[model samples]
Target: MISSTQVVTLARRPRGPLRAGDLAITDQALPPLRPGDVLVRNTWLSVDPSIRIRLAETTPDGYLPPFALGEPLAGLALGVVVDSRSPEFAVGQHVSHLCGFREHAVVRADGATLGGYGGLSVVDTLDHPPQWFLGPLGSSGLTAYAGVHAVLDVKHTDTVWVSAAAGAVGGLVAQLSRLRGATVVGSAGSPAKVEYLRERLGLDAAFDHRRSPLTDRLAETVPAGITAYFDSVGGDHLEAALDAMNPGGRVAVCGAIAAYDAETPPPGPRNLFQLVSKSITVQGYRAGSYNDLLPAMQREIGEHLAQGRMHYEETVFDGLESAPAALAAMLEGLTTGKTLVRLDENRS
Candidate 1:
């Protein structure tokens, strides 16, 4: 039985980019597991941009509550069950749960889930690395899957633009659209990420959004007009997409990273009227609501991984101590692909 563990806690709310002083690694005592509780030894922690939203004083409606000062941060994590009081889970089983930012977590097998995600569940690593479960095969994959198939309804004939295309979710969306024979245009913050989209991911066209006005970049990359868009960055990017969208275009709004770090929400796109004029469709969705599509998402992405038909990338920070820095870097677009924290490198 675990007695104590170190966890990352919110030391204070940050008005801008996160700094180490805003967070602290504190030790806490764990109580004896109750019946139906599963204790896990966490191996990998996911560092996502969405967490930035929660660091603010308030979150958007229907989203998770903000993290209070001195409370541990929760996120998607992969761990092996070390002790179990529940018949449903066995010791040594690998499970994914929301009790991350700590070396060990005590999960209630039947407890409430975080927006239908981060519930205690078993997972098989199969031939892939255990960490991959936290990346392409896990939440990131599910998000990309839902936005493309369930929301955007991308078709082969449609041209699609994926913002933040070099990141985890965007990269998958781009490749998935391409697999259906759609022409895919991607935008990233850096020339290197643009090169990655074109040379590594084989995107139809790619551009650095930071290099010029997004409207011009869109014209240069997708002059024919895109029929579909998978949006992560919301501000000017959404405005640009709206301007470049063809009549009857579809937009799957997953996140607003452009405003995640802002002290207050930025202004909405000034061109939203284009939706009415052009008969366009814009929908916002979260992965939790689309749980029914999980199996198909995992199977298809798994096959793509096995066949080498898809490419995935990650920026891993070593140790739990580095998580704060990792989050800051990811928020600044300083890291590429899926940002993650690797705990216990000697173990896995």
Candidate 2:
């Protein structure tokens, strides 16, 4: 008999700050696997900006299902199959899914996908770790790649600006745009991140978003106005980007991290009329809506990773207990690049 540990919700409709008290760690008895069920030993769990949206009772446009109180929280997770009744997933394969934040999970086998994490496709792959799949090769990478290539339509001559430029998605967006021959500039919350973007990520130029008078900084840096804006931090950043956009520029609305945890919703852009005058195109994007483009994006990113054109870093915490702190760090702009939690590191 195997026991499972899971992170369960203790609150309903989170109104204010999410604390450690909102989650409960409990044990459960595992049920016998059915014909198409597989028992997964979760290795890494993704802590992304989207998870904060899941806590709300009302999701914008009903794209996300409401979270059930007392139920296990679910998001993108990478795991290994310790036992399986399904032939598609063998006993030692690494896989990922929208699985629970549990040490052990019994997933409906037919739903789990395969064939990522170093392309080794076996036990040897686990030696290298499968957590990377949740970042670069996983949904995060796809989101960044597609946002720049498909949605924003970046060109060689374009000047690209990425908000929240130190994040997993934003970092990749800047790298991809640079690889595509665009002059990329990024905005991060701190000077350290601004330095990482410039010196480490090789961004053409970078700025600290927290600096005084962003419009003045942007005007000084980009005298010609920004040709493309990959906006991850909305609100003031969005307004500044609008004010700096050249005629016929493009904006990819990837995320609004600046306002995600805000108690009061920020006002809409007062300069939205600039969109009309500048003939700018601003489009809100959801990665799920663009999954079909993942293959091409993956191909490009895989080649970039292989050739050293793109690089990523992650701040990983151990155990489910660290999930909340990791999330809070990410929201507070304390984490660099991607943030993840390793529950069963040895398993991976």
Candidate 3:
């Protein structure tokens, strides 16, 4: 059996923005597999904004604890089981897991859960590229599905505005909402992404959040006032949504990427009283909490994907060492769609 493997670890806590120097890739010895242990040779690693929250000295209460200094950092990953001590996982089976940031992981069959979703599960790679499970068909897809359908319960008559709409989950939420016949507006960080949202994704309106004031763009696009908002970027974005929301509007809160790297948490949107006046329903959730919806999500989203009604983009780094740089770029909004690291190039 292989002995040593390279794994990404927290060397130092980041201050403002994350730097590659704050993370370290170190060699570690793999322990022998016990009963129910599956040895996974990781191939793809997901780089998510939520991870930035845990990298801070403290995570939001009721969330996962922060990664200890020098501890191996983990996130969603895809891999093939190279060895197995349990019949539950056969050798050569593909699996989706949370024990990532390493070349290998010894995952338990009935292991700890990720958020609320089960941590380790077999994934069939027949109809799709395996890495897609780390993106649209897996957690990203699930998050979007939960936000757009479950939390927001978007209606066809609704004009929905999706913030960070060019991102992994946001992009999926935009398309899913559009497929449901909503008039969709999307906001991104760049002009090119805006074009993608307009021309490619065929959103009703698309704008660069960096170009002008957010309120002005919202007015320009949906002058009638959006009836629903899908928010991944919090802070000013949340406040702006509150300002632009129509009476009886609904908002889905899935992520807060805006102040993820800030030294101190940004204050809550000052306009929350708008909820009382406008009868707006602002609901925050993690996809894992809505795990029961996965089957429904997979069927609808998978059908849309197969029929060309949906689109997904990914930014993949070439090596395990690149994971840190990937995380840094994603936090700086320098990456489009889902950012990931390619660990095993030999995978078919």
Candidate 1 lDDT (Cα, 0 to 1):
0.89
Task: Estimate the TM-score for candidate 2.
Answer: 0.89
Instruction: Give the higher-TM-score candidate: 2 or 3.
Output: 3
Clash numbers, per candidate: 0, 0, 0
Cα lDDT of model 1 by residue, 245-265, tens digit: 999999998899999878888
Query: Residue 8's C-alpha lDDT in candidate 3?
Result: 94
Model 3: colliding residue pairs? none
| TM-scores, one per candidate | 0.97, 0.89, 0.97
Angstrom error at residue 316, model 3: 1.3
Quantify all predictions' global Cα lDDT against the true fold. Answer: 0.89, 0.78, 0.89
Q: Local error of candidate 2 at 25, Å? A: 2.4
- Ordered by TM-score, highest first, the candidates read 1, 3, 2
Candidate 2 ranges beyond 4 A from true positions: 8-17, 29-31, 110-129, 345-348
